[model samples]
Target: MSWSIKNWRRNQILQREGIPDYIWQKLISMRCLKGLNPDELMRLRECATLFLHDKQINGAHELEITDEMRASIALQACILILNLDLDYYRNWVEIIVYPGEFILDYDYADEFGVVHHIHRIAAGEAWSAGPVILSWQDTIHTATRSGHNVVIHEFAHKIDMLHEGANGCPELHANMSAYTWHEVFSQAYAQFCHQVDKRQETIIDPYAAESPAEFFAVLSEVFFELPLITQQHFPSVYEQLALFYRQDPAQRWR
Candidate 1:
């Protein structure tokens, strides 16, 4: 029974790999794929196609991972890495999915070694060397509204973790200056925290206040979803993300 199930899964995946262009074209037409021009969008589609072929996603809660569903998730996730090498996501293999939001459990010891248990209910999460988890409801909410991009946000976190810990800094390209990145991001992050503390209304989401890591993840959502605001408010950070992601989204999204 196990061998038969594995053989069937292999066949299904091979057939899905060469997914047609029009399917991706329709995806690009999605409001969420905004901020990228025609050429960039096409590149996103190609990279997404390859990504769909390469990665494995398992559906839990009796929900099956369909071709359309996987394609939709892959399209947005890999677009961030399209300009860079696929090796960025190479360390991770599987993606886990549930029909809806799920709960996570973990136990930790503080600096004092006082053991504590933590439980979190979240729509998505990225593991350092493990699977990316998602909720089907949130996945379908892509590009609609509510200022969320679970896949992009989680994968951005993965990108951040690629270098070391998720301290909001990802590995940079040859052209990016490490000092300049730190200066701009650190200053902006402090100001954002200050603004949030003062209760100042800001265009970017308030969730960005959680921490530098949250700021990077939240800003990544806006960097693609609401590029104009990101560029207008944090031009330097916007430029840095553009360079890091290797795509000028502000121009296209606007």
Candidate 2:
């Protein structure tokens, strides 16, 4: 059957009903939902239905993944789909959750073939064609409007990867001019790097300087979290992001 707002409420990710009021309240209160409005909420709910229907969410470690947990994650994750589409997340199948901040082991090789031990802490990750991993602790606190959402960031990566590997460039709509995207983004990315090298604070996070992909993800977070601020500081980058995401968040969020 075709997915639509008309039939969305009739569907649920889980058949086990009795969803708590608090869960609904949290979802309803989310800023991302606000951009959707009441009518759009219905469509977003349908996208959530599809997300829950297709994706398998797993609770890693000792975490007890509850209905609320799934619902909360689905509600926000699907909003990107509400505007874009489900195929945006084509590569991943699971939303793995660790109870708290999980440790990731990294190995670095030297000229002498010596391996260096490296550990890193992350709130969430978007693997290429792999499942998205997130920390429940960070996930729970990551309010949709805070300009720092792991789900949106990871999903944005998925969108960026659709064209090829996420070099911060995605398949833009036909109406969009490619050269404008390149001109704006190149200037902004370069300026952002210069500031980062000087250890200077920027309106857009300097973490964006880490890589083109990271710039996309970090700016994506700020796009929704602080759309007004992002547009104000980096209007060029903001326009490009608005074009790619297909949403005028600076306007909607305002």
Candidate 3:
């Protein structure tokens, strides 16, 4: 769609089905959303309203969906795209919320072409060009915790997927340097992996050591939730993230 038409439709959605005041107030109070000025908050609200209008959020395993639940999810998802456009989440339309950690059963081919069936409990999962699946229990529990947000983690994957399937590099803006992004993230990921291998206590999640893609997603969680930790530990990576997301969360957090 053209930018003008999209903007018109978004305005209509904001006018016709804006978020309730109480829910918006509650969302703004979230730690992850702290330090947004009035104008940013307004833009976030409009983006969230458009998000709720465009996406389908449904409960699984007989879990009932409520307005508060929907708003909570939408608000966090919108935060990732607050400085950018909501088009970052384009081509996805569903968010399935389970009551808690749900089982993931799937088959995957290993690097050697060996197919394996795996089953495990998962708090959240995001598919390329598909829905975002989450455990609502974990979502609420982690939302308030510093450096832990399942919603942001999964949505960050979606953003990373927009480039070339989440290899720790999203599509950079024209002004941003791809070489610098790789140099910074590759070093940070390696160092972080070494820390994890040594079982060293760290502020960021160890799960990030799993892969470069995971490093990006998990670092994204830290970037927004505990910007200071990200900046302190990986200053260069933090700068790249600030440029990519187009927001200085550390500044906002301060």
User: Against the unseen true structure, what C-alpha lDDT does each candidate score?
Assistant: 0.83, 0.76, 0.91
Each candidate's number of clashing pairs is: 1, 1, 0
Which residue pairs in candidate 2 have backbone atoms (N, alpha carbon, C) closer than 3 angstroms, thus clashing? 147-225
Q: For model 1, give the 10-residue run with minimal summed lDDT.
A: 10-19
List the candidate 2 regions with Cα displacement exceeding 4 Å.
Answer: 1-22, 106-118, 144-146
List model 2 lDDT by residue over 106-207, tens digit each. 785755999999688887877677888888887778773356777777777877877877788888888888889878888888988999898887776566
Model 2 TM-score, 2 decimals: 0.84
- Residue 203, model 1: Cα distance from true site in angstroms: 1.8
Q: For every model shown, what is its TM-score relative to the native structure?
A: 0.87, 0.84, 0.95
> Using lDDT as the measure, which candidate wins?
3
Model 1, span 1-254: residue lDDT tens: 99999668756654666567666656766555766767876667667766777789999889988877888888878878878967788777899999999998989675599999979898898888889999989878866765678888999998998897688999889889999999999999999999999999977778889989889999898887777878998999999999999877767764
Give per-residue CA lDDT, model 3, range 47-97, as digits (tens).
Answer: 888899989999999999999899999989888899898889999899999
Minimal lDDT window, size 10, model 2: 10-19
Tell me each candidate's RMSD, in Å, in order.
5.8, 4.3, 1.7
- List candidate 1 segments past 4 Å from native: 1-16, 35-38, 109-116
